[model samples]
Target chain A: MGTIENILIIGGGGMVGQKLAHALAREPLTPGTTSALTLMDLGFPPGSPAGARQITADVSDPAPLRAALAERPAVIFHFAAIVSGQAEADFDLGWAVNHMAFWHFLEAVRQEHLASGGSYCPRVVFTSSIAVFGGPYPEVIDDGFPPAPLTSYGAQKAACELMLADFSRKGFLDGIAIRLPTICVRPGKPNKAASGFFSGIIREPLNGQEAVLPVGTDVRHWHASPASAVGFLRHAARLDTAPLGQRRALNLPGVSCTVEEQIEALRAVAGNDVVALIKPQPDPVIESIVAGWPRNFAPERALALGFRADADFRAIIESYIREDLAPEQAQRLRLR
Target chain B: MGTIENILIIGGGGMVGQKLAHALAREPLTPGTTSALTLMDLGFPPGSPAGARQITADVSDPAPLRAALAERPAVIFHFAAIVSGQAEADFDLGWAVNHMAFWHFLEAVRQEHLASGGSYCPRVVFTSSIAVFGGPYPEVIDDGFPPAPLTSYGAQKAACELMLADFSRKGFLDGIAIRLPTICVRPGKPNKAASGFFSGIIREPLNGQEAVLPVGTDVRHWHASPASAVGFLRHAARLDTAPLGQRRALNLPGVSCTVEEQIEALRAVAGNDVVALIKPQPDPVIESIVAGWPRNFAPERALALGFRADADFRAIIESYIREDLAPEQAQRLRLR
Candidate 1:
């Protein structure tokens, strides 16, 4: 038997992290090798993927994270961050969790690498966001577009990407920052993120609940299914980084559609009742924030690197239904 | 008279800082307004500009920086950094000084702002660099081009820009990061930066000393004179940041020229005897590093905001001869 690869998911309790953990549990990161999984977070939600060892700890405190790094995991998926709205509202906490903690984590990894006689470089997959690009954006943000983050959350993420790329360049650890699109059909309840309604408009309606669409139906955004996000993480871990060549941050592929198109897709999947659940309530605050977001991308580098996106907006909704729809929600949908 | 504007130059011992300090001593950042200047660095060279208070301290330690912030300087010109070559060689020192210190400094400013009942918002001018970009670049890198720093130094500078922009966005401080082109014809002995030869090729020959031309004459690079660098810092400090909006980082203008052009310009300014002093001795290490540097920029925003560049490469060379040529070197050139 081949050696078992130890894996660490830093924000493993979050939606994407849990999905990644479950995916890894089902199949090893590498096809032929067995792997052990460890998840770290402030706390895991109930019924988080079982069997994976959990380390309940705040990223704001570095002590616990340092202990986690001691194990020398082969692949470390770093997803810990304060979401956009919270980061914007609470600058200190955002900088603490999103920027400072990541700096400490990288340093800890470097310490581990140095202690191991320079042979313990791990694959670090950091989930950066499209928020890194501010408005006055191109019609299609190409690979060459600079990151002008409009929000503190974005600035923090962009800062992390810079560190990751530099550390990787210096050979401390192999790192790839995948600038993820808004994850649509995000499972569970809506959070305080200004972009949360992108998922809420879909998730809430599918669960037989009313959803608030704060911006206009004309509002367009880039999106990927939660499954694609997991796939991007895995691909980043296994892929050869040679092609990335210094520019380690990548804009991932996603479906670009207006809220109107999204509504049509929801109607196509779950009928008029589900579509009817979406209420258009124009919010000036969300409108201003959304205005600064990127509507589409020409993620040529990511696509060339074999990262795939959902086929279309319809396919995106279908993936959510297939992968995340709860039994009660499914029953409720059938009754409608 | 208006209230005296308190100014703090964090890297006041360095070349650009000293130039800025001298300029501030001569006049004021805002014409007709009295201003007080304080310089901070590890140490200052002999004969630094008079009339300004000097604080000798390493930026790696936050305690001293916090103490400096206690004074609540109204305008902070942050230039403290481990230069590119040193930063690349010493990873720990580079990140500590270049990235972490800046974070602590920003936080310290925030603390002061909070302590002052939210009234202390200082104008922060950060000296960033063109190194924030890497190769595979466009003919003229526009304002939209993202920073993909090929060196640890570049990454550190880019990270600082992010933090500064974020802090400014949150109204914690009014910040602007000006990405200066390579400062050419640097006075004193040549340093270890890969681009040192850019200045050495010009400065040494003018001083009647032999200098090596490591790369081919076809190599083009962006450059600004030391005087222009000070100008940029001062302009950034006084410029109304409203036009900057959320994107606080600006790409300053610079002279772009090839080595062949630089040599021709030197011949025009001096004579064949001086130009002949430049010998061709290829160094692969420097050649490789130089190849990744940006060659030109279309800094539209900065130009629109009234930040000017040297008229041409000839003007850049003249600025150095006028401001930095030592008396002994001038006598040597006269003898030649």
Candidate 2:
């Protein structure tokens, strides 16, 4: 509780983890000194450590992670998940990584807490997704919405959320579930994720490459910046949970926009030349996946707790340019 | 399908089962026909049933139920549970009866469907409860509300609902979850159910005996009559599930009233002479349990589907008199 000196990030090599580790290192925490941290991912941080210990370990097989947890970290951020496309393609792997591993992680925490005479329950902040809300929606969603997940991935996350709530209520672990919107302007190379295209059309085009917009421009979605997502995790780990009472899982706030609006924002920030770098190539698979997702949510609970998102879609684009793009990247207008 | 000529009722000697059996017999679903009906309970039925098949079988041990189900029942009413109070008190029994047996039942149905090649997945009407909804609510609950069950019993029921939804979606079982409100005006000796006093106060006093009114009279509750509950099960079994689509569970509507209102209705029915039989006894354990229950629900979906309940408390009392009590017993009321 005091400064979160010794921290462990389970599944810490992912996109979200990398940002959160950097954020925690830069923040001024309590206890008057920056705390020591351990970042354990399936892969090590690319360069050197950023003021913390780095370990590469597989979480599904817990022998190594259990050893790491023995260090008795003050907080644990669990972000490990098989992306929706991969999980839907491979059922066994989905069960292993997303479903079964979650139970293993929880049992590990339970044992650690009991061993400490109920005095050492670390704060666990789990990253769930908006995919947990399936269709038959009211156009705008709420956190109280029942999770009638259409895919195996959503079902597993919903099940894990249930376990977290149960274990926390039983006083075994201090748990929080933050249902994150799809992170917009994700600064990375295009991946095979079904949701990857949400960022790809924007990110790839911003870098002067024509990216295919697979779904129609009318499709609306809920989004958060990678920075905002990392902030959400930090706040979830540190927020006063007593006010939440029994409502452990909260829907994190996000920006709701149609794809056309996203394109407009990109045009405003990077010029019409950058926007023209996008091409429409419809894919039914992507359209089907996107159609099932929630477009908007009234996250009153999380907003009341001071969680926030980008002021506008334009700001989201500007943040990407300021953070991800090189200074010398040229567009048609700039070349003239 | 096909007139539901053969029916099977599991746990058919418990309070709910006995009432259902009496209702079914009185109605004579297929009069003077050789349509075999089976009722399986852990205990034997009260009277010798030469015509109806009564088997003493534990549902958790699938062998007996499997054998009974092989008779090709067209419909199954599963009303078995170690009630909330008992289930919460004993963890092992709770898992055995409430959680584990449900999976066994579903698996059995899956096998039945596989063997019959989609010819005979019996319509399963499970009596789920308002216990499924936990706190952090508005004035009225809705069907789409996320189930944040606060107790082990509620969790088990929610798990069953999820499993049932999965099975129905997979085409393994024709399933529906009817979340009944607490069945009020229960006509039996008081037992250990935490919600029992809700019924005991009015029911026992109606029979000219003192009944302990634990907790305050102002506490509000949602209620349905046993007869209406039976009708819910029967209708739910036969309803068109196509509109239900992927969401197989239905939250049945009920009458929400304050304890004082309930007493007032009882006074109207049996006059102040019978009301004097009620004694106020404050009990904290009962109060705590009652506090967590949902007091009202806006069952818009259920209402649109044509389900009905008593128009008022007076109608509910009258239904009990005309249906549950004998003529002589009704005459003893003297139309006060």
Q: What is the C-alpha lDDT profile of model 2 across A1-336, one tens digit per residue? A: 444478788777877787778777877334465757777777864743467787777779889878877777788889888888888776557756886688678878877888899998888899988777779788788766788877767766876777677667767788999999888888777655788887987888877798999999999998888888887888888888888877788888989999999999888777787888899999999899888888999999999998988887777777777666666763443563
Model 1: chain B TM-score relative to the native chain B? 0.97
TM-score of each: 0.96, 0.83
| Prediction 2 global C-alpha lDDT | 0.79
- Find the 10 residues in a row with the least total lDDT in model 2 chain A: A327-336
Per-residue C-alpha lDDT of model 2 across residues B23-118, encoded as one tens digit per residue:
665564454534356888889646534466788889898899899878878778898888888877764577468766876888788788889988
Model 1 agreement with the true structure over A111-207: per-residue lDDT tens digits = 9999999999999999999999988887999988888899999999999999999999999999999999999889888877999999998889898
- Write out the backbone clash pairs for model 2: none
Model 2 residue B99 distance off true place after TM-score fit, in angstroms: 5.0
Instruction: Report lDDT (CA) for all predictions.
Output: 0.91, 0.79
